[model samples]
Target: MDSLSLIELFLSALRFAAPLILAAVAGLYSERSGVIQIALEGFMLFGAFVGATSAHILGDGVAGLFMASGFGMIVGMFYGVLVLKLKADQIVAGTAINMLAWGGIPVVSKMLFDVTSNTPALEASERLPNWVPIVVALTVVAVTYVLIQKTSFGLWLTVAGEKPEALRAAGVSPAGVRWIALMISGGVAALGGALLSISLASSYTRNMTAGRGFMALAALILGKWKPIPACIACLLFGVCEVAQLKLQGVMIPGFGVVPVQLVQILPYAITMFLLAGVVGESRAPAKLGQS
Candidate 1:
């Protein structure tokens, strides 16, 4: 490839990976606090819808970004209530939330925009600059690393996941720590969603996130739940996605011309390999789902 082509590819990779980076960090915070957060997809989907709608209405991309994070916290708190207060199964609650996002978002879109499709197309004035997501993702990673490695709350977060009784003895409520973690996680992941709608694309389309949220979760596991490594993994996945796009019509010796649909599976297939322990084994926190 020419230098210009290589630069374009690099930028495309960054755009693809940025949202996953934030989502993986979101998982890091919640899972580290002993709460499993499979509802990340739902939270992100909601954020995308809200972000697009708000940006279109206000004609201000920054305002939409803030509103997206705010609503995401609300959804996170709702998930907390289900799995924490009501003792719902974490996996079940998460699945329900994902389904809820898929079905409910379109309904809301219909009511607000009179279309069971996506929100209205955003004008240039309503869209964020492409570089915005790349910067936001890196900044979030840096802040999260500092908070997790250099703070008292980080200690409580560790204790909550490893030994809740110990945290209780220290007079710090493990549940409280998890609640704060989940809320922060929801907001951060919502920013990822907002980035997808406002920065990566012009507006929110139904299922616009595709499987990026779950892919982010996979990246988290591949990185063994660490922040910087997880972001790196997200970027790697992004590179593969861009490669797939570029390879869509290329000829393969045995495979012939690559089908677009087939090429798109590269990222998800990698996710499955990671999940199946093909990449390596990963251990979760001891009390990950314990209330």
Candidate 2:
């Protein structure tokens, strides 16, 4: 309604978009390197739980963030071994990873804190500054752009996904390239997940991600897998989320009041529309998901 309100709304949108941007870029790294990463949701959930639990134990949020990244990488490496070494179906492996996170976090939480869902609330000093995640997300975007467009490793990644045999002929192991890519992906997505607990919320709650990982996938598709465009798509989805929050309970001249459930579906609804419109035109790497 006013300039101040608009600015606040924009800030809120940025905050909401940070995790999506992080995870979308992370997914880009994996998919662009010929590894499908449907397990982003799982990676993020693990990070959230680990980040919260570690921070609570160590009394330090930064330490928790590192722990989250470490665990995420471990899981990512496991995923790589399953898909690349054992030749497991990438989609199936990723789905299993997601299911693992859904079930595992609670079990671990119960073991550690005697709770099966959430960790204790963190103090302000124990949480990340609000600016930290926003800055980190943007930095990752710039770095990803450089990594993909201005580096030899980037070239190798492209070849690994589009023509793995070419990379192998060049004396590079395409599997190695993919393994590294997935590791980076997991670490980045873990940062996004840590931000959920240490920056956005004070504690890690069960299923708090609430499909943001899938939304990030949609953003990745909408952006055509490019870093800058994916960030823009994330912002767009963030706008949808903020609109959902802002428009709920508002009176309409002819519609009375907006339904909260419908408002809540704004981001997801937009994602479905964008995916449907682009799926036919979008093209993935030639060798993506190939063993």
Candidate 3:
């Protein structure tokens, strides 16, 4: 490929990585606060629907993004109540949230747009520029780094995850810290989905996230719950996705013509492969998943 082609590819990689970065960071706060973050996929799907609907009605992409965050916070609060107050199993609660997104969206869409599948096509004006997501992704990463490394609250978060009893002795309510973390996780994760529908695709479609939420979770594990390292992992995954896209229908020297289906599976396969290798060695927070 030429230099320009390489530049374009790099830019594309950044674009694709943007949402994954946000989602990973979202998981970062949740898991770091001792919550298992399986609800990310559901949160993203909810955000995508809310964002697409808000953008379509309001005709402003930025406004739509904010709306999605708001809804995401609500979803987070709901999740928090289930797990924290009701003492529901975190993984099962998260799965229920995902199922809610899958079933509830079509009903809402039908009521609003008379379409049970997707929202109307968005105009160019409603879509965000490619650079916006990259900037957003990096800014979130920097902010997360500072929050995790520099703030008193960040320390509280770490303690809450690693030792809730210690946090209690420090006179901080671990549940309170976790509440804030879950809210942030929902909001940021929703931004990931909002970007997908409003910036990348211009409208919401059913199941549009396509497991990027889970991919972000893997990135978080690979990063061992650190902001900068997690961001790097997300970028690497983004590059893999871009490579898969670029290699579709291409002939290899010895492999002959690879099937498009096989090429499509490459990124996901890489995710599972990397996770299998790394997760066993990576240490999680001490108090993670405790009810």
Clashes of each: 0, 0, 0
Q: What ranges in model 3 sit over 4 Å off?
A: 1-4
lDDT of 2 by residue, 120-190 (tens): 99988899887878888899999999999999999998899999998999999999999999999898898
Higher-lDDT candidate among 1 and 3?
A: 3
Candidate 1: residue 128 lDDT (0-100): 95
Measured against the true structure, the TM-scores of the candidates, in listed sequence, are 0.96, 0.97, 0.97
lDDT of 1 at 210: 88
**Model 1 clash pairs?**
none
| Candidate 2 runs further than 4 Å off | 1-4
Which is the winner by TM-score between candidate 1 and candidate 3?
Answer: 3
* lDDT comparing candidate 3 with the true structure: 0.93
Candidate 3 has a TM-score of 0.97
Candidates in order have lDDT scores of 0.90, 0.90, 0.93
Candidate order by lDDT, highest to lowest? 3, 1, 2
Q: For model 2, give the 10-residue run with minimal summed lDDT.
A: 278-287
Kindly give the stretch of ten consecutive residues in candidate 1 with the minimal lDDT sum.
Answer: 273-282
